[model samples]
Target: MAQIAVDSSPKKKNFLRSPYMLTIALLPIILAAWWLATTVTKSVPAILLPTPESVWIAFPRVLGADGFGDQVLRTLTEIAGGFALGASVGFFLGVLLSSSSRLRAAYLPFLSALEAIPTVILAPIIIAWIGFGIEGKILQAAIACFYAVFITTLSGLGLAEPNAVALMKSLRASKWQTMVKLRIPTALPVIFGGLQLGATTAIIGAIVSEFIGATGGLGYLMLRYRSSFDTAAYWVIIFLFLVIGLVVYLTIWYIEKRFVFWRRIEVTRPDLEKQ
Candidate 1:
């Protein structure tokens, strides 16, 4: 007689799944929706609402060698340059303000005033001062990005609990030592939040500047296509904006995941823990 064997192992599901797989799964559904809308619709004219295939075909013309690729490159360069300058300056100022009460009180009002100024409205003035080249775009992006990082960093600097700071002082830690050992780590989540916000705003700032006056970029490309009534190409430029925003958000998200991994607050479910 054969004996039955018993096996016991925990059944586990992976929650950290790849986003690419999800995108692939949704592709078919999206295609079906697009096909039905374009093929079976008398609700609207085709010229007003073109098919997904038309948009897809136009994408190559918009992004290919003869199209908007060079423009995209120029925009990327301006955004990157601007964001780097803004984030660096903001981070340093944030650290300084956090460490000194006098400095915080002295400069915070000025910072707030800077933020209150609508940078987008000043595009023409910026162009007048810096010209329509990369400089104006960089300045625009930098100013917007500065506010994002600055505000977030200020919040992060104060996020540490009072008790934690007291304990550090009780241990006879120097101000700098306490900052490095306790405060900065506690601020990681908040700082990362600022970085994400800044990165996103940088893109918007760059695009807005490009729109005001640009020789190249999706903004310029859209303008060219619109003048010629190439609405398909116009839509393609809009698609490029969506892609650029998604890419910027994702890149910062990846960086946050890497640096702030240790800062996660673990939530324990009583029922699960009891089991």
Candidate 2:
């Protein structure tokens, strides 16, 4: 009998397939295009679209004497507070609604109506009632987040497998146990999906509130810069806003990846020997 030898080899990583690499690659092209538009061709007026170097130079001034750092901190704090309040209320309400059909039927219409009204419209009223401070901004963010979280959470809870519920019931599991052991875990993916949307909406709400009325925040900073026609500083502030939004989104994405591990796709590497 002849013996056959098997070879095992590691596959080479495809650098171009990496999402991070692709994103990083795109940045230089975007910057070049922006530079060409602003500097070379001068298609857009300098007053409107300042060069990248101007924005870069404005960063230190914006961060230092302009108090841009403080404004960022203020906005972040408002987002955090509002998100916490909204998430708490939404989660509890969703649980209540899911557990009680009668309550769900009675209150869902009202909740939907509230959600239908644009959150930006409420910003003025909130500012007037609570004053142009972090509190009002927080309330606006909370209101913006509330509806999305509530609706998604309710939908998630409803989507829990009926067979699992029946099994829990047959096992004499208490309502609380059923929720903790079955419903919540089942609903986590959808709930996190809602949370992602809520985080974005919360940021938008805070900014809108600040735009309506605020002593300090990025939105207010943008308004001040726009009025002065200091386009460089305006772009810098816009960049900071983008950073903040990216951070919020990435944070939630990280949480989802960690806690919702079961939903992650499994990547299998092919065996070179088999091939």
Candidate 3:
């Protein structure tokens, strides 16, 4: 007699599928699904749930007609400035703490505590103190970004194998030589991790601070749309934010590829298997 059996677990499939390509393919399907649902139900009004076409048409109008272009440009400028400042500070501190045990021990706890504090809550106080300008935004972004890089650098530096250190010492390598040749190279992966985290948070910090007080930005645009109950415009602003975040993320990813070529052999082995 044959026995019936069921396979309960899902099989793991190929990992070579590009998430980017999948997303692009799925976007139109999503829009179609949304359009059908709204049209069939008619439960929600068009004003409240404007179709994708409406959003597309309205998007360009915001460029000049409503000062959307200028707002976006200003916001991008602020984000770039803030991210640069944060990344610089984070990288420096990371290197410092990695090299100095005393500094890491003394400051790691403080850094952890600072990270626990809610950045959103700090926005009002920062605005009050710094008067709602670029300085406040820059400071906020820098602080948010600092700990990630610091910890990553610390861990990466620590990851230097003892044998490697011993070999360097036996070779009478100078402190600078040891650091440049061995410690720093071993820590590159961790440093890159910190950099990616810092870069993403920098964008978040700038946008959040702008939400608290600013006359420009995608965040500010979101605020205005919220006040007037223009959900469509709010959605558009949100989409723009997603795009900006993606851009920053890709930038960091590109940097990682440039710096961590050694990791690629391992990372892309799945592609080899698929092919």
Worst 10 residues of 2 by lDDT: 265-274
Give per-residue CA lDDT, model 3, range 1-275, as digits (tens): 55422332245555546566788888989988878766666666766786666677767665545676787887787778777777677667777777777988999788778889877998898888978667787787777677787778778878888889999999999877988899888888888888888878877887898898876777787788779877667777778888888988898889887888776565445644364
In terms of lDDT, the poorest run of 10 residues in model 3 is 3-12
Span of ten consecutive residues with least summed lDDT in model 1: 264-273
Q: Give lDDT tens digits, candidate 2, residues 200-269.
A: 8998888888888899998999899889999999998888878988998999999998998755432132
Distance (Å) between predicted and true CA of 274, model 1?
17
Model 3 vs. true fold: TM: 0.83
Q: How many backbone clashes does candidate 1 have?
A: 0
TM-score of each: 0.81, 0.89, 0.83
Which candidate should be chosen as best, given TM-score against the real structure?
A: 2
Judged by whole-model lDDT over C-alpha atoms, candidate 1 comes out at 0.80
Model 1 misses residue 193 by how many Å? 1.2
Q: Distance from true position, residue 107, model 2, in Å?
A: 1.6
Q: Candidate 2 has which clashing residue pairs, if any?
A: none
Clashes of 2: 0
